[model samples]
Target: MRTVRVELGARSYPIYVGEGLLPQVGERARQHLPGRRLMVISNPTVLGLYGTILLEGLRAAGWEVLLAEIPDGEEHKNLTTAAQLYDRAVSGRLERGDAILAFGGGVVGDVAGFVAATFMRGIAWGQVPTTLLAQVDASVGGKVGINHPQGKNLVGAFYQPRMVIADVSVLASLPGRELASGLAEVVKYGVIRDAAFFAWLEEWVEPVLSLESEALIHAVATSCAIKAEVVAADEQETGKRAILNFGHTVGHALESITNYSRFAHGEAVAIGMAVAARLARRLGLGFSQEEEERLLGLLQTIGLPTSVPPDLDPEALVQFMQRDKKVRGGRIVWVLPRRLGEVLLKEDVPLELLLEILSNQA
Candidate 1:
């Protein structure tokens, strides 16, 4: 197992990435999390697949494990579902000393972490991510929350998990589209942070996509390390951390405008990166067409969406972006790439430029 540490001093935690880590989740949780009564939150689909083994492991480890299944999907990640979880926790008589175990993908992690952050003022939570997207991005940083009516992740908090158990083996069972969705974030890490990693991806992406053990483990570990570094530097997103949202401005807007059913989170981000590329070229940010093609080509190779849905209204999309949490002084902060492995935050992008870019990309 490759262990990456998020060095937050008092809040420091470890992320374990490897094959066959699922079966060891209970033992790991016992080491990191401080609680007896554990609430394992997941979706029906995931629970149906690995629930029995996971529960048995936890019980064997002496955890008073309770199962709370949230209906799967991004749309269900809202206050209603959180309220239902709240009901379960109250009825379960869970106390502040207990913890929550996020047992599915990003949706499960976000809502469960939110509950842990707010339930009885706060509680501990750990992540057992089953999807590549969650393993590489969502499950690492402390960002947790549900979607609001206006924007994605608008109502969220920075609640870090105690430990993250990312089992790459679970990814082999993912649908083709879901696996492709994760590669989008994997590509993001290269674009915004490490040129060497990006170059490595150019050569090794195929093997990683094929679930070759070495490449998969390396991808997950490297992605987690980059995020861990970013999160450690700007835990509250007050500065450098915004770089982590390189493709998220338009990405989140796309998810909001489409009601989140048309595209997965990483797919929307893939399209967002595509749009950002054009925006960078238009603004003379030194991103050449060749570089744009290189980035888009990687996404295309992974079967990720690289263009905005033609049916989405540009104005409505802009309206949703205005509601994004990154907006500062009423100006939407955009994390646009200057080149592969580097990004710049710009809040001065004109409305006309944004509209024109969206129109062209669409």
Candidate 2:
């Protein structure tokens, strides 16, 4: 297994990546807290897929086990879902020493982590990511959140998981759309932190889409390394961590504009990245249309959307972005890539410029 450490002082943790990790969840987690109860929070689909093995493993470890299964999808990420989970934790008699096992994709991890953060004034939590996106992006950083009626991840917390277990085997069952969606996050890593990785991905995109073992491992590991460094520097997104939001500013706005149903999280990010790249060039940030075009080509290679949908109102999207958490008080902070692997957080770019970029998109 490949291990990456997220250094957060008291909340520090490690991420373990490899295949056949489901059955090892209990043993691996026991290293941190020798004897504590585990409440596995999973979505129904994931529970059906790999929950049994993990549950049995925990049982064998002599730890109390409880299961709270929610439905799967973006629609399920909300206050209502979180409240339901809180009720389950309360009913299950979760205590401070006990931890939550987030077993599923991004949605499950987000909800489960939030539950651990708020339940009984905070309890331990671990992540068992079951999807490519979760392994590469969502499950690594401590950005746990739930969608609100007004926006995506609007109602949430900055809760960190004690550990992360990414079993790549679970990705084989992912739908094509889901895999493509996950690649949006992969592309984000290259755009923000590794130009060489971006260049490599320009060629490896095909192999990754085909689920080649080496390509997938390299992609996930590289992305995790970038995230660990960012999270280490700024656990609460106070400064450097905002660079990780390269496509997320507009991508999340689009998610809110569409109510998180029209586009998958990564799909929206793909389109948002293309928009950001073009904006970088238009704003004379040492970028070019060629870079944007190359990005679009790569996204297409993976079946991800590279263009904004006509149905979404660009102005409405902008309005939503202005309300993003990154937009402190009144001003908006944007993570723009001046070139591949070099992202800068700048607040000077006028909001009109953002509207201009959105308006030009079809």
Candidate 3:
């Protein structure tokens, strides 16, 4: 197993990436979580596949387990679902001393973490992220929330997990499109921080896509390490950490306008990155045509969409963006790539330019 630590002082935690870590979930939880009680929040599809193994492991480790299954999909990530989990927590007599375990993909992790954060004013939680997207991005960060009718992740908190077990072994059953969506976040890490990692991905796309052991470990470990460094430096996204929002600005808007159905989170990000690249050029941020093409080409090769849906109104998309969490003083903070390994946050992107980019993308 490859272990990457996110150093947040007292809130510090380790992310373990490897194959066959699922069965060890109980032992892992015992080490990090404070109490013996654990609520395993998952979706039906994931529970049906690995529930038996996980429950058995937890029981073997002397945990009093409470199983709560949320229906899968981004659309279900809302207050209604959170309230259901809250009801479960209350009925189970879960206490502040006990912990919660998020046992599925990003949606489960986000919702479970949100419950952990809000229930009785906050409780310990850990993440056992099964999906590639969750493993690489969502599971590592402390950002947890349910979406509001107005925007994505509009109602969330910065509650860090006690530990994260990113069992790549579980990803074998992930849908192909879901795996591709994850690669978009993995690609975001390379684009925002590591040029060499980006080049390595370009060279080893096949092995990574095929879930080759070494390539998969390296990809997940590296992505986690980069994010750990960023999060450790700026835990609350006051400054440096905001760069992690690289493709998220436009991506979140796309998700909100589409009602989180048309495209997966990673697909929206793939398109968002493409738009950000174009915005970089338009804003004279020094991004090159070759670099833009490389990004687009890589996403296309991995079966991700790089263009905004033509049917969506560009004006409407902009209006959705106005409601994004990153909006400061009503101006969206755009994380634009200056080059492959670096990005700068610009809040002054003109409305006209954004409209033009969106219109052209459409």
Candidate 4:
């Protein structure tokens, strides 16, 4: 097992990445979470698959566990769901010292974390992220929230978790599409900070996708380490942390425009990254044709879509982006790539260029 620590001083927490960590969830939780009272929040699908193992572990460790299951999917990630969880926590009598365990994917983590942040004005929570996207990205950052009608993740908080338990073994059950969705975030980490890692992915894509133990653990651990470093330096996204949203600005727009039903979050991000690369090329940014093809080809190889759906209205997409949280003072702030392993946050992208970029179907 490899551990990566997100150094947030008093809020510091460790992310444990390895295969077969699910059965040890109880022991790990006992170490970080205070008190014995706990609420395990997961979706119906995940609960059915691994809930018994997790519950058995906690019970064996002498901890009282309350199971709360929510419906799965991005559409269900809303204030309504969070409110329901708040009720569950209250009814379960979870005190400030008690902890909420998010035992599913990103949706579960976001909703449960938000509940822990708001319930009793703030309580402790931990993440047992089952999805690759969650394990590598969402589980560590503490950027928890629910999607609003206006936008994705508009209603959320920067509440850190007590610990993040990522059992890579759970990924064996993931559908191929779900696995590909996670590769998007993994690819983002490479583009934003690690050129060498990106190259390694190109060579070892097969093993990584197949979930070979060593490659999988290394990929998850490296991504988590990069995220941990960034979060520790800029916990609230005041400056440097914005780079973490490399493709999220446009990705979130696509999700909001489609109501999050048509495309998965990572799929939207894959398209967003493609569009961003094109925009960078148009503006004569430092990205090269070779780099663009490499990025797009890798995404296609991973079974991710690399273009916006032709049916969606481009103007509406632009409007949604303007409403993104990254927009500051009515200007969209984009994290455009300068090269592999480097990016810059630019707020002065021309509106005409953006509109053209979004409109171009090819």
- Top-scoring candidate (lDDT): 3
Error of 2 at 155 (Å): 3.6
Give model 2 RMSD, 1 decimal.
2.5
Off by more than 4 A, model 4: 323-328, 359-362
Report lDDT (CA) for all predictions.
0.89, 0.83, 0.91, 0.88
Q: Write the per-residue lDDT of candidate 4 for residues 205-276, one digit (tens) a residue.
A: 999988998899988999999889888899988889988888887888888778678888899899888888
Candidate 4 lDDT trough over 10 residues, lowest sum: 322-331
Q: What are the per-residue Cα lDDT tens digits for candidate 2 across 1-362?
A: 67888888888888887777788888888986534788888888888877788889888877788888899887898888889988887888887777888899989999988888888888888898988989998998788988767555777788888889888878888998988899899899998889899899988888888877777777888889888888889887788888887888788887767766788889889888988887888788987777778777888887887767766688788777666644456566777878887978777776777777787742
Model 3 lDDT tens row, 1-362: 99999999999999999988877899999999989999899999999999999899899999999999999888899999999999999999998899999999889999999999999999999999998988998988799999898656889999999999988888889989999999999999999999999999999999999999889999999999999999899888888998988988889888878877888889999989999999998888999999999998988988999888779898888877875543555567889999999999898988888888887742
**Regions more than 4 Å wrong, model 3:** 323-328, 350-353
Across residues 177-289, which tens digit of lDDT does each residue of candidate 1 receive? Answer: 99989888899999999989988988998998899988999999999999899989989878898888888889988876776788888899999999998898889898888
In order of TM-score, best first, we have: 4, 3, 1, 2
TM-scores of the candidates are 0.92, 0.90, 0.92, 0.93
Winner on lDDT between 2 and 4 is: 4
Q: Which stretches of candidate 2 lie over 4 Å from their true place?
A: 34-36, 322-328, 350-356
Error of 4 at 275 (Å): 1.6
